[model samples]
Target: MTAETAVPAATSFAALHHRPGEPLLLPNAWDHASAAVLAARGFSAIGTTSLAVAAAVGLPDGEAATREHTLRLALTLGSEPYLLSVDAEDGFSDDPGEVAELAHQLWAVGAVGINLEDGLGPAALHAAKIAAVKAAVPGLFVNARTDTYWLGDGDGDGDAKDTLRRLDAYRQAGADGVFVPGLTDPGRIAHVVRCVDAPLNVLYSPAGPAVPQLADLGVRRVSLGSLLYRRALGAALDAVADIAAGRVPGGTTPSYDEVRALERSVSARASANSTG
Candidate 1:
């Protein structure tokens, strides 16, 4: 379907729920093909990774240099047959209204959800942005993320209390979910789950608790942020290294036509569904 209709149709928090045993394993995609492939493989939702989005444009992550590329990818995959949740770093601006405007654009392109991180920005300010975005697009699922552990220590008791205060502010500001990327302590995760009224989202890590364990810990959403994208980059580097060393790249590589067919297949299906 066209982005316009597709967005409104799927735009709701209902898509964010995870069945008790079925934890949300959100795959991060860098481009349309990656997203399509994941969808074909039965992933119900796909997320855009800031690292991949930035690296794809030869920019640095957390620096907001890939806004156009990020939006372009959103426009490309947003109308795909699965849900899309964008990783908008600090909303690309400190102004809440500007952030809300970006959220509007994302929704216009068919994104049903958005992941807005504070990146350790002022808690009140981030809360304002969340509230503004929700006011502009009430159906958009706002996943408010605090980077206390990712970026700061919160000092001591003061910091910890501040973190909780920020999370509470985000929840009161209408976040459908809350995310703390660097938090891995099972006790802390459970405590945060108890603290937030909305669903709790955690970043899935190789060293962190397993999916089942996270679900058991009350994490409603677990995102594979930048893992797939980084792995793809690693594979590219490996292949290049092998070529430079006079060694063949040994991996299950897709034929050129197989790669091309993905675009054709997904586009055709999307078109047929759009017109049907």
Candidate 2:
């Protein structure tokens, strides 16, 4: 299986954003087992978590250190039975051409979407990356993310304005959708939806509105970015502490057989690909 075989999935993934009243719930996966389990659970799309990818490799996330890891993950999960998106933090470079080339590589490896964050950099620079990515891989859904709200002081008025301003620039640069994480206010979310012509994507926060609430706010996509990975890490620690303290760990742990099934599926896929 290759990117060419996954073209139909890219089209189907783009259509998921257009469904009325039911926004796409994209779960982020860190590796093959995680992604396979998520796909088996029926997630139509799965995104690679930069945090999990970096943490797994003992590297700092969002600092452009995981370019090779990100590409390898894309290659591994690209042919899975779900849409794949890579979180290329800051496009792994400040240069628009480099970002565009990354986008080309991601698309070549079977990722249908790429998440590019501005990291509070120059608005024009982020917009240029979006423009270049679109020009290079038009089929790759460019979810242009602005960290104004994520990285700003909690001043509602100023942050909202900055968010809209950056989103406007990215949208004009041909971004397929816009993401504003750390934005939890319902009224503010509605206002952002009204202001941006592109589909609105919000990061799901436990402290923020729920999925149904976001759908009511006119959001088209909800991403659980790094949340699942963080929770899994937390669960592992809790289980270890409970075992060390001689207490029964009480959590929903997957059965060993179930996990082995995931491994079996991966082996089966590899065998099929090798023989096909």
Candidate 3:
């Protein structure tokens, strides 16, 4: 609960992970409208979707091509009421210092956490990035992500040793949490949860375990990743098809005034310190 605690943001965000079973269900938002709506709906923390960030600019995802877009979006959402965690894919560079600088900039803009993915690259390099970020911004929660399952080139269940090794390294290097995006097996998940020293974050998969099941398996954070963006795209397609077939859209649509209110709610109360 954000503004719910009225405490230091990092403390509020870090506390969300220690609740034994009730994992923090972080929904990813793409733009101002999406983030605003999610915040209005009472999500204490919001994360940016890297996929949507790149796609919105007609660029590719996971190629380190969206750093500016990502930072610009973070600058836009950082001053909001809720805690913000960014999905900085691979930290947008190979050098540790660069990643750390990015973390510092994000922290300066009011981000409480950052997600750094390994992309199945060298585990040692990812660990270095994690360490550097923690050294630069001690208060910023670092959620170290490893893509062993996504790029393992084998069955998801068989990448246990590699996953454990990478995640453990990240933990030792000061990662506040570890994320495995493509992992969904209950036994494997519970296994990683048992092995990793830090909080375990698993990407929410529609065909895999639901929130309750994930909670039961001891997951501490569940990320939506790009699911919301993908679903929104699907909704747009469905709505257009319905209109063509002489049928109205089925999903809930916010009124124009209500949408406008989301913006005015923020702009109406400018900070007293703004010189302009």
Task: Give the higher-lDDT candidate: 1 or 2.
Answer: 2
Question: Tens digits of per-residue lDDT for model 3 on 72-174?
Answer: 9988888888999999999999999999999988888778899999998999999999999999989889999999887776364457888998899999999
Which digits, one per residue and each the tens of the lDDT, describe model 2 over residues 1-276? 365666677788889888768999999999998998888888879999999999999999999999999999999988777889899999999999999999999998789999999999999999999999999988889999999888887466888888999999999999989999888899999999999998899999999999999998899999999999999999999999999999999888889999999888889988988898
Each model's lDDT: 0.84, 0.91, 0.90
Which runs in model 2 stand beyond 4 Å of their true positions? 1-4
User: Judged by lDDT relative to the true structure, which candidate is superior, 2 or 3?
Assistant: 2
- Winning model by TM-score: 2
Provide backbone clash counts, one per model.
1, 0, 0
- lDDT leaderboard ranking: 2, 3, 1
Residue 252 lDDT, candidate 2, scale 0-100 = 86
| lDDT value for model 2 | 0.91
The regions of model 1 sitting more than 4 angstroms off are 1-13, 154-159, 242-251, 266-276
After superposition, the stretches of candidate 3 with alpha carbons farther than 4 Å from their true spots are 1-7, 154-158, 271-276
lDDT string for model 1 (1-276, tens) is 364575455543345564665567889999888887798889878889999888887899887777788889898888777888999888888889998999999988888888998878778899999999999988888889998878886345665676688899998999988888888878888888887787788898788899999999888889999999888878999999999999999876778998999868877877887798
lDDT value, residue 17 of candidate 1: 60
The C-alpha local distance difference test score for the whole of candidate 3 amounts to 0.90
